[model samples]
Target: MLATVIHAARDIRVEEVPDPELSGSGADAIVRVVAACVCGSDLWPYRGVTPTDAPHRIGHEFVGVVESVGADVEHVKTGDFVIAPFYVCDGTCVNCRNGVSTSCVQGSWWGGSDRSGGFADGGQGERVRVPLADGTLAVVPGPVGDDEIPGLLTLSDVMGTGHHAAVSAGVGPGDSVAVVGDGAVGLCAIIAAKRLGATTIIAMSRHADRQALAREFGATHIVEERGDEGVAAVQDLTGGIGADRVLECVGTKESMDQALRSARPGGMVGFVGVPNGGPELPVRQMFNRNVGVNGGVAPVRGYIDELMDDVRSGAIRPGRVFDLELPLSQAAEAYAGMDERRATKVLLRP
Candidate 1:
């Protein structure tokens, strides 16, 4: 099988590799790769920001058909089309039961050493093994049209993460919301805010394409400014009171600061961006304004079902974020396009 292998920083290649073997019997399954996507979070390892040994698999968000299932796997069966959550968690765990599968006590990060990811050696290939299949994989309701696959794939990660950000911020009827970052996840955050009944959705972006998509996703306002100016722009649009809720989709300190500053006093800030270097909190500013900050890596597993229905019904078109598509063999080009900010999200077909 051919897979995308990141041998070193700025070095990625499509290479023939041995397929993964399935030996686990406790809630495990093997899936035939249908489609996979390059993620902004994956860029951390691609750019050497995260230390990784050469030749590691690189993808996490994917949709596939089940090729096989372990004896204990009951939620899914062979031939089932499913979306794999980026995090593997047992739905029965204490944290999972509390609706926090992202922090499942027995869960592991998707594509980590303990559990192989779906990038190169995983979903980027013809087939991949998924551990904790019963909990990690969400079965699609029925056969999805090719046109719907992109949106269905979003249920695996980005769209779910974006929805998590909006939910965490408590976006409600007539609320004013601000979304920082214009990546796929950020654009979806705008959609999520709209779905939550936000009256004014503000997207902070400089890219014309992404800005356009933001509007399509329900952003009522677009702030092209950066840093403090961007925060002020959001405030001005909200009668100088700032947004009622803010979603931070960029992990950088600058983006985090903007999210914090863009929220009104007593407002909430929800962040889903993977913090590469830990960001500092403006404790004094937050205290002065009585602001509340919450959010972490999204618990996508918890929201997949509802999101899947929305996608299938055409209520949300988060899949439009995939402005570029390529074969698995061109994984490097996908990375380059994202790194250069030329594409919001890239989709790959095996």
Candidate 2:
């Protein structure tokens, strides 16, 4: 099978690799790659921010069809269309039971293990094996076509993460929410805020294209500022009180500070950006304002079902986040497009 292999920084290639075999002592499922996406977080590995000495397959968001199942797998069967969650969780764990499976004690991240990933030898290929199938894979209702695959694939990661961010931040009816990012996940956060009943969604974006999408996703206002000016704009939109809830979708220190400063006193900030640079928290400011900060790596597994219903009902069109599409063979191009901000999100068809 041909898979995307990252042997070093800025060194991603599509090459033939041995297919993965089921060897884990748990329910397993083999899924044929249908639609997979390039994530902003994937850029970390691509740029050598994350260590990878050996050739690593790099992908986590994907939707596919089941090709085979292990003996213990019962929830799904061969031929079933499914979306694999980015995190491999043991559903019975304490965190999983509480809908925090991303922090599950036994959670497994796709593509980071010897087990390979859905990116190259995984979902970016013809097929890939999914461990803990009963817990990690969700079967999509009805047959999915090419058009619907992009939206469905978002449930595997970005869409769910965005929803989690909005929910955690306590976005509610008539509330003003500020989303601090213009990437796919940030755009999804805007959509999530809208779905949660926020009336005034303030999207802080520097790009016109992303700002336009933010409006489409229900942002009532767009702030094309940064630093203190960005925070002031958000506060101005909220009548000088700051947003009722702020969704921090970028993990940098500046983004985090913007999120904190953009929220009203006693308000909540939900952050899900994978912190890239070392971001220091202004504890004194947070304490003085009594601001509630809550966020972490999104546990996408828990929100898949609810989000699927919204997608199926057409209440949300998360697929719009994918502005570029390429064949799996051109995965490197996909990465370049996203890194250069030429595309909001890149979808690869295997």
Candidate 3:
């Protein structure tokens, strides 16, 4: 099987690697990856901001067909078309039961694990093994086609992350909202805020193409400014009170600050950016303003099903984020395109 391996900063290659096997492993499911993508999180390692090894498998967002399943995997079966959200968790855990599956006791992140008993799990490859299949893989409805693959794949990560941001901020009907990034997640946040019944949406996008998509996704206002000017723009549009809710999709210090300041004094800010630089906060100030903040790694597993219904119904087209598509062999170019902002997001067919 062939998979993407990042050897160093700005270095990526698609090469043949040993195929993954089910081996009847504990609750494992082997999937033939039909579609995969390079996430914004992938940039951390690509830019040398996050150090990675010479031959580390990369990527996490994916949709595929189940090739085989372990004996104990009950929900997913062989030949099922499925979407694997970026994280795997044991459904029986306390956090999962409460719907925070991203923090499941037995959680493991795709692309790589963190300190909490998580490690690197591959998502961009010809095939890969998923742990805790019943909890991790959401089987899509039958008869899915190539055209819908991109949208379905978004359920695995970006779309869900955006939805989480909206949900985090408690967006509701008739509320005014602002989104703080122009990347894939930010655009999806616009779509999510619309779906959640936000009547007025302010999209803070700096790019012309992204601003267009933001409007297409239901943003009523496009604020292209940054820093204080950006906050002033939102304030001016909101009659000087700021928006009712703010979705912070970029995980940078300035972006975070912009999001915090762009909200009304009591407004909620939902942030889901995989922080690249250290993003700090004026904790005392936010507290004094009574501004609420919440959001971290999205519990994608908790949102995939609901988002899928919207996709299946043609109510939302989140997959439009993949502006560039390439074969696995062109993985390096895909990375370059995204890094240079030439692509909103890249989709790779393996």
Candidate 4:
């Protein structure tokens, strides 16, 4: 099998690697990847912003067919199409039951060590050994056509993360919302807000292409400014009251500030960015305005079931965020396209 390995900053390669096999707790499963993608978060490591002390397998979002399952795996069978969440967790843990599976006591990340001491291959590969298979892989009940595969793949991460941002902010019917960022997650946030019944959706973006997609995904207004001006733009769109809910999809300090300031006095801000250089909360300002903040690593596993139906129904096409698609062998080029801002997101087919 061939997989992506990041040797260093700006270094990405797809090379032959060992094939994954069933392992761990008699519960692991091997998934033959059909589609995978490059996330904006992956760029941190690719750009060397996040230190990569050693070369490792490096993707997190994928959709595939089950190749085999361990003896203990019960919910899915061989040949089933599945969406694998970025994190692996046992379903019976306290946190898993409470819908925060990311914090499960037995939780492990993709591309890292599995519970059995064998490698858990990253999504950017021909096959992956999915830990906690029953809890981590969501089965698509019926046949999945090639046309719908891209959309289904988004359920593994971006779509779920966007939905988390909306849910954290308490978006509801007739509320006004502002999304801070124009990356894949932010655009998906627009779709999520719309689905949650927000009457006004403001998308803050400086890129023309992303702004267009934001509108297509249900953003009612586009603000091309940044910093204070961006906040003012959002406020102006919402009749000077600011948005009722703000979704911060970028983890930079400036984007966070813009999101916090774009909310109304009593509005809430939901943030799901990976916290690259985000700042500590402005305690005084939040207190003075009665604003609230919530969000973190999205519990994508929990939301997968909730969002899968929408993806199947064509109610939301979050996969549109993937502007480019490449073969797995061209993983390095795919990374470069995203790094250079030439692609919003890239889907790779094995």
Best by TM-score: 4
Give all TM-scores, in the order shown. 0.96, 0.96, 0.96, 0.98
What's the TM for model 2?
0.96
Residue 236 CA displacement from its true place in model 2, Å: 1.2
Q: Which stretches of candidate 2 lie over 4 Å from their true place?
A: 24-26, 114-121
Model 1 Cα lDDT, one tens digit per residue, 1-350: 77777888778888887776665555678888899988898788789998777577667888989988878889899999999888778788899999999887767754444443332135555677777788788998677788989998998899999999999999899999999999999999999999999999999999888888999999999999977788789989999989999999988998988889899999999999888698789899999998898988899999998788888889999999999999988999999999988888999998
Report the C-alpha displacement of residue 287, candidate 1, in angstroms. Answer: 0.7
Q: Pick the candidate with the highest lDDT.
A: 4
Cα misplacement distance, residue 330 of candidate 1 (Å): 0.9
lDDT of 4 at 220: 89
Point out where model 3 deviates above 4 Å: 111-121
Tell me the deviation in Å of residue 242 in model 4: 1.0
Worst 10 residues of 1 by lDDT: 112-121
What residue runs in model 1 are displaced by over 4 Å at the alpha carbon?
113-121
Q: How accurate is candidate 3 locally (lDDT)?
A: 0.89
- Clash pairs, candidate 2, are 4-120, 118-123
Per-model CA lDDT versus the true structure: 0.86, 0.85, 0.89, 0.92
Q: What tens-digit string does per-residue lDDT give for candidate 4 at 1-350? A: 99999999999999999988777568889999999999999999999899999999999999999999999999979999999988888878999999899898888988998666767899999999998899889999989999898889999899999999999999999999999989999999999999999999999888999989999999988888888888788888989978999999989888888888999999999999988865788999999999999999999999988998998889999989989999999999999999999999999999
